[model samples]
Target: MIEGPMGAKPEELDELCELVGKVFNWQMRENFPTLFCNDNTDNLRIIKEDGKIVSHFGFVIRDMIINGCRISVGNVGAVCTDENYRKKGYAWKILDQAIEKYRADGVDMFLVSGSRSLYIQHGCTHVGKVKNYAIYRGMPIPSAKVKAIKYTVDDLPVWSALYRNEPIRFHRPYNDFLVLTTSGLVYRPDSRLFSISDGNKIVAYVVGSCDNNKKSFGLHEYAGSRKAIIASIPQWFEELNVDRCVVPVNLYDIEFNQIFHSLGIEPDYGTTGGTIVIINFPQMCERLLPLFEEKIGSHIANVLTFSERDGNYVIGLDGDEAIISDPHDLARIIFGDPPILEAPTKIPAEGKLLDVIKAIFPIPRPEYGLSYI
Candidate 1:
């Protein structure tokens, strides 16, 4: 198989897209190229067999300061395998190559919009969970003196200033900000910043895109006061012309549930957002240890255990005398089905599997609407 970046000729891309469409049973959109080759061109990888495209995966390598230290990470996406070549191990081969390339390129961490199983096999650990929150059309929004408007280019400088001042937990390039605001997806009512002003200061603003056929709006970003956020909900809904709005929710927050309940909105479904596997243990520990030391204190000496099998990772955490596995595995025990622990193992009296799950897979509360590769 031939492995390389977007330097492939135009005819090569068309052939690849055609193969992807045939395999996935969906039309590969014309916009797929922009998704892969835009700003982050270095991390893209394509697999070709005998001069014909077989599988494709896209990724972005970015460096971010986490807890005061710069850490390099690879964000993966746009994964697809040609259907005619199924059961031939095309995906595994491509991923194997990609992971090696990422390591060679000096990425210490990897994250993707997939399940724990996908990255686990690649020596990655499940460090977090991402859940989608939805507000139905009938939900009652609390009254507040907040306002919102569609985003515009003139507002970019101000928005960029605000974003840089209080950066979101996740990483995003400035160009992505421009793309989301200008593309038909995210909307702002006026040329100037469409925002709610608390007297003179902007309080809360909603940034998102809509899927017309599904009548659903996906929120990419939100900022400002809680009161402003609640007050602007109705306008945000009407602007998108959608019956429901969805945003990612962190599992740790009780406030999210309270807000949804108070608004008379019930979530339609909650799916796994992304899978994480710890590749460089010491590096990851070095980066995140201080945060744990300061926030959770030193009650538990954290040690993570991970295994690779079946093209997925099976992650387990050991602390003191306790052992824990999958986050959903723990959730099933507490909420619905029996726990999926493999055998009798030591666990903390108060340390539910969910706690370990949360520790390994900490979900970031905010949503990233920009489809960056």
Candidate 2:
């Protein structure tokens, strides 16, 4: 057995499909033969055993806008290991390698969908408390008519803008968005992607699959204006025969909760959202400082600084003026989860320092954009 990063070569692509299919039960190769044909492959790390792919872990670096500033964020996905190779430390080894590589690559932060314990061991923390909204088929069937149309490569910029409607979201390139819209067939052949249009303008779009067993359509990602999203409801019911639609508060923005509340679709507060790992604390500070200065006023932002000790992350000024927070709390604080910041902490919860921190980092639950889970 040998370990190394695998290229998206013809033979390697076949092995990837086989390994992924065996472990995840998907026909990756045939469903999406051109999987990596256009995707950037600088970070497609893998570990092999006996001339076949056994384990894999990879990240795609994306340009993200936090507080109107462009920052590079690393999104980790496609993490899987061959079933026969499980419990052999292959995952840990590959994950460790991915972290080290990301650090050197200047990634300010890392985002992932699942696997909390493994990421926590690598200095990551699970964070965020977001509300989920579900619209049932019997709910009066909204009057809005959202026309669904197929999107072409030329429509990427429009889609990218719609995708980044949130305060915190990854900046997707044309190629990456293209891959996301089609990659599903690699996992599910019958998946669909379309732009929900209002007359000539594209209002919202949904990428999802249907579960025949339950007669439910699971939305992988949905983005656009609230009115647009709500208007598009008829399309889901008519085209997919989906009786229910589940979405996050961030996806719909602040208008989602209030509008749905009136319609009896209240939020479910039990969800944690996603896991975020800060790759570089000080670098993160440097990038966010300008935004802080603008929002919190120079009096506070001028003196504030970000640093880390041991494995703990924090942001503050000199002496005992620091705000001690873990990656989890920091992420929540950054995303404006009031409870986490206002919770018991060494930092002053309601003072000038806290005010400054909140002013700049006050964002809703971060959105990963088009290729969301």
Candidate 3:
């Protein structure tokens, strides 16, 4: 009795959660309330056999800002298959269906929470660049004139305001924001939210958790002033009483990176936030027009176009064009690849075209943080 690579109906929700909990050993409805709710049945793709759902793949759609431009992104997670059904291609089939369904629904990209072979073979790549740095306690870095206080329900307005200031971030509606901060338990263990304040005014906030086994504090998400964010680290270290604090710095965050460099801390460059698949490159380029204008001029940004010929990408400005032979390389060009790569994709343009591509490209990739699906 094998049937369906189809959408999960509302009635199948409890069964779906049972399968998810059986696989992951935790209730999906509890950890990811936003995604596994009764209303989200349509987004859950599944395969049923022997009178039960044996395989599942789900995604939640949300709009995210990249340098002020909003683009639809599908946050894919909770993918699972019954142990008896592994290697039968059910997961792959469901993934293909999900992509097709979402693309037609106008989703520009997908951000999977896992970098498994299933995602890699489906054109999802780990091209978003970041640097991981460990700052040990008693480091010479000076603490700022700020106090770090645990976040409370009363601070929701200011918290949302500070998060909105992030140039590249999720378009989290108030309800979603509240749900994520309060209920998103998938974000490591014992995670806590703290607001950094200068006297009475809140300047920044961080959401992270301590790993008792690693004996370290991890800074997962932060917003507001980069300087304030950096200055508040030492205070966190002191409060947590950890020997080390692990910080992931986005490659495009120059000021934050510079501050770390000033402290003489070397970074280990790596790919973060799982793999990504660019479903509609043309739509991505179209939606990013504002970011392009901000980088170059509107005169040049307005003329840019993106298209796919065969399996390669064609990026054009005015009448000049550059062909990207590999989709992975094209993604790296648009976002970023690790700095340590022996061979990274080069802009295949010359003169003004090259300059424009360099100035605007490799835009900051949005960190999942609390928005991790």
TM-score of each: 0.65, 0.80, 0.92
Whole-model lDDT values for every prediction? 0.53, 0.64, 0.83
Q: Which model scores highest in TM-score? A: 3
Task: Evaluate residue 110 in candidate 2 and report its C-alpha lDDT on the 0 to 100 scale.
Answer: 77
For candidate 2, lDDT tens digit of each residue in 1-373?
Answer: 6857544454465566667667766664444332333354445567878877788765667667765776677767667887777888887887777777777878887777675688876655555556777777767645665577876666667787887675666676656666665543524566667787778888777666677764676665667767777767667777777777776665325576777877887777533445677778788767776777777677777787777777666666544344555665665556444333345323344566566665676443455434443
In terms of lDDT, which candidate is strongest?
3
Model 3 superposed RMSD (Cα): 2.2
lDDT for position 371 in model 2? 41
User: How does candidate 1 fare on TM-score?
Assistant: 0.65
Query: Relative to the unseen true structure, what is the C-alpha lDDT of residue 331 in candidate 3, on a scale of 0 to 100?
Result: 75
For model 1, how does the per-residue alpha-carbon lDDT over 1-373 read when each residue is reduced to its tens digit? 5544333454455565566566655543333334444444445466666667677776766654443445566667667767665676666776787767676667766667665455556544333334466777877677776567655576676666555543334455677666656652332222123555655666555565566464786665655554676667677667656787676554544666567667665554443344444444345445655554554445542444334444333444453223334433322322222122344322233454346534433323223334333
Candidate 3 minimal-lDDT segment of 10 residues: 180-189
Off by over 4 Å in 2: 1-11, 29-39, 49-52, 138-146, 150-157, 164-166, 183-190, 211-215, 262-264, 270-273, 323-326, 336-351, 358-362
